[model samples]
Target: MARQGRKPKGRPVSGWVILDKPKGMGSTEAVAKIKWLYFAQKAGHAGTLDPLASGMLPIALGDATKTVPYVMDGRKVYRFTVRWGAETTTDDTEGPVTRASDERPAREAVEALLADYTGEIEQVPPQFSAIKIEGERAYDLARAGETVEIASRLVQVHRLDIVDVPDGETTVFEAECGKGTYVRSIARDMGRDLGCFGHIVDLRRIAVGAFDEEDLVTLDELEDAAQEGREPLDEAAIAAGAKARVTDFRPLDDYILDPATALCDLYEVTLSDDQAGRVRSGNPVLLRGRDAPAFCDEAFATGQGRLVAIGSIEEGSFHPKRVFGGRH
Candidate 1:
């Protein structure tokens, strides 16, 4: 069924991929690679991880992209290493040395500084960050040798624990924090508090929201699977060089989480077939008793064991906020 000489486009893939991104690869690049491998129609990521850092980067394909906002607002956990004695222009190893110090804080001194960062506190983001300054990225401005004065904003650090002090040169630690918390800022601030300039040398994200390390799939594993002919195309697609119909790529089910899992933390409301249809049509449905869970604001409606729509509650009624068509 070829129409003229138009090139073949892949099929629609709808799911979430919790990628264990390798170090030195940017988050955007990881998303692009996964999108290409899957030949997905649409894709996006929940958060941005620096090229110098690695670990859990959730890629949303097709319908799953709708739930990205909720995942981005979720808490995150990171384990990072801070190298003392010098501060870098980017607050990490990627940037050049901007300041140096012979001073090194004692283990006790570092421990005391953790408390200062915990809870809600005002902290300035690193100058070499993606934050916008007058519509231009702060990093771009800083890179151009322009003075970038980023204002301090309040961020929450739920837990800050020192995992190990590998000699007197570096400190390994873990941080559990809410949205917008930057690991590099923590390292930068800690250095200033200790009077010894410091910068993050290693960083890895372990968890984001409900997705954790256990859910991650390495890019190499996926590539290896493809090489093994795990993704078999249908006869017609193969003839057309389409490979587009290879939706049933073997082993992908193991790596790809159900699109519904993206909204697992939210409340669930299973609706009748008629109600589900109405919700899909962007109509509001009145929920009663068990269907209406107390203190539930955000929820997803399911019908026939498939995700129908994501909605919010108001006046004991569930309103279809983001309607999802087709299986997620």
Candidate 2:
């Protein structure tokens, strides 16, 4: 028998990739392309963008996948076009025409409808969505010609701006909302309020969490850059795309941001060198001088020390979740 090679050791390549997803491609396809490009051992996207939408899709690689859910829970902003006169089964252009109306609401009427969605409201997700139905995906159920009735959930629309009326019928609007707020659902509700039926003809997510469209690199651009012997995709390039959302940790001299920057938004607790070492060893460290709130899991250093770990405080001590550095 041939000699077997030894398994590789140490950590694998890990980071985040912010892709400017193109229209007509599913989120899974984008993730696969990136995985192939980097030859990553593991990869996952923070959120899913519809085939009709194009914009920032944050992909987490290696250990960064553990932090994806925390990033995905952040706010998102989108610019979408609502076409008056018809509604689709999926609420976007992907589905068949389920309803139609000849009444075209005036531009002002559409603007008025925006107010109704400005605050918290219940939203019924479209049938052709990724939502699970009795352990199966809702979209799968819908495609199989099965009746799927998804429950309505409350979502917040922080800001809804009517950017332009762009004629008498269509409305171009920008929305900043919490996670799970579907722009297509907004379009459908707006139509109902305006005494017309509408559906999203074009949808583009401009921002997700702190990542923005400006930081996005298109698939074509990334491939072109790779072919020209330019910079290859790596953890650093991937981290750059997620930089906008990461909080600034450098006090003044240090300028480079790492993947840990993503945790900067959380309230920080400084630890001494001894305390940090213990924390990295997975011990609970008691914090002082701060009344840390729940969900704040980050910790900084007191001197020229490195961040040791992220921990949750309970019973007056911090229990480490992730460890980075030790006494130095």
C-alpha TM-scores of all predictions: 0.89, 0.79
lDDT (CA) per prediction:
0.85, 0.73
Candidate 2 accuracy as TM-score: 0.79
Estimate, for each residue in 1-328, the C-alpha lDDT of model 1 and write its tens digit: 8769755466466778999988889888898998888777788999998888989999998888998998998999999999999999899998899899999989999998889989997889999888999999998899899988899999999999999998999999999999888889989989988999899998999999879888988988888765664456689878877643334466554567767777878888889999988898899888878547544578888888777888887887788888877333
lDDT of 2 by residue, 151-183 (tens): 999999999999987876788999999988888
RMSD of 1: 4.4
Model 2, clash count? 0
| Model 2: residue 221 alpha-carbon error in angstroms | 3.3
Could you tell me how far off, in angstroms, the CA of residue 270 lies in candidate 2 after the best superposition? 5.6
